[model samples]
Target: MPSGYLDLAELEQRADYVKTFEGVHIPGLLQTEDQIRAIFAASVPKLSEGELEVRVRFRLRRQEILGGVPYEAVIHEAALRIRAADSKVARGQVLQILERSEHPQVTVRVVPFAVDGFAGIGDPLTYAGGPVPQLDTVLMDTPHGGAFLDAEAQLARYREVFSKVEEAALEVIESRQFIERVVRSA
Candidate 1:
């Protein structure tokens, strides 16, 4: 498969070979149906009702990696707390994360809000597999669209930042508990 907008699709096809890092909100690969609908509705408000459903289904299709693949995510506490579209939607999102984290192929960690001056403080990113074992790319989310970075230097920097962010984040079990607490509060 060609790379670009279909990067997520490619990742799903080659699920065993992908590793991802998400700084804001849960990664699409881990989002629930309700959470995905809310995100698409807000992000693409111009879509007609029918188009919205199509897009949400497409987004949910990306979650196949959670079933049988090696994937990991490092999410920030602030991102988890922000209501994607509304409090109800956000609550459901947290529950989804809690459920998905139990899978053997998935690892979800939370970077606490108290972490001082983290590398991924301002932006959320996606890292995808490349053609080679040591090759990979970084995709940064933008207001206009996603920007893909394939240069080795840029990918290296982002990888280092992700490593640091993970170091500053809660352990997998702790992160799950935090998400459960948030869901219960909602």
Candidate 2:
């Protein structure tokens, strides 16, 4: 869980743009209600039914940012094929990416499995903008929890990581087509 001052909510309020990369799971801000519920249902320890509902509600609420923020998500093809729930939910997840990719504020790109020399194997990351370059922050997910990095050296490394990962991703139109194929075969 995130703290109050530096949580995703507060960070989003301060940033104008956010770029993310997801490997094994869908990024939170881009997830739909049904997909989020499915993710929560698969919690490792197994969240209680009530806990699952609460997390799902919180996740769905965060997705509202997609309508206004200039957000870009580069997702791995493996994440798309990994089923979080039944076929219905997996199909919905594929279509969700396709539908949201069409939004003016949201850009969804894919890092196909065939890409060579891919570098983003660590974890999901959100690189957020700040009023000045010096104030930028990088948020990386971990099994323990979320880790925030702001030192100049750390920021620079993540910046390079994001750039290389983004470059390996398909272009907007190609990404949409790739996801559309997944949807059709789902």
Candidate 3:
């Protein structure tokens, strides 16, 4: 509750579809436990071991929504390249992404560095599609908390932004291959 996890989790649970874009780090739902642990270990104020484990469990629990609904993640190449923990952990994390991409309800796309006319290197965003167009919400996470937008205009803008970002990414199959290359290099 203090982390606003409950609010975001509830929204994801009620949504029919979820799409996320990440430029700096892997999306939480797709992260491995080790990866999540590494991320929490870097918290500014620092968390105790108990607190870190609790957060990790909460994050892992949130991934259950992916099994019930379609989830699409369009991640930038930079996120794939960055080492969240160590080489072993980073490689393991990408491998997990590759494995998850094969799921029927999961789609993973890559935006390579060679792509031209691309400018979506800003903060990450998650667009959750509600049952009706009027119910859709766009979520952007900040250090302070989650920001939810449901106004027609704001939703339309984010939808367009997500469309453009998805267009810039490689196809699912190509993304798998690209990730394989990254794994091999690691």
Preferred candidate (TM-score higher): 1 or 3: 3
Pairs of residues at least 3 apart in sequence or in different chains that clash in candidate 3: none
**Candidates' TM-scores?**
0.86, 0.93, 0.96
lDDT of each: 0.74, 0.84, 0.91
Flag regions of model 1 displaced more than 4 Å.
1-4, 130-134
Count of steric clashes across candidates, in order: 0, 0, 0
**Cα lDDT tens digits for candidate 3, 97-141:** 999998899999999999998864567999999779888998997
Lowest summed lDDT over 10 consecutive residues: which window, candidate 1? 1-10
Q: For candidate 2, lDDT tens digit of each residue in 72-152?
A: 999999988888887888898888888888899999999999999885465899999876877898988878778889999
Cα displacement (Å) at residue 108, model 2? 0.8
Better of 1 and 3 by lDDT: 3
Q: Pick the candidate with the highest lDDT.
A: 3
The sequence of per-residue lDDT tens digits that candidate 1 reaches over residues 1-186 is 114547657655763455565666778887878877777777544677887787787777777656766777888777788777778778878887888888887888888777776753457777766467356767788777778787888988888877777788889888888888878877
* Best-matching candidate per TM-score: 3
Candidate 3, run of 10 with poorest lDDT: 1-10
Better model by lDDT: candidate 2 vs candidate 3: 3
RMSD of each: 2.7, 1.8, 1.1
lDDT of 1 at 5: 45
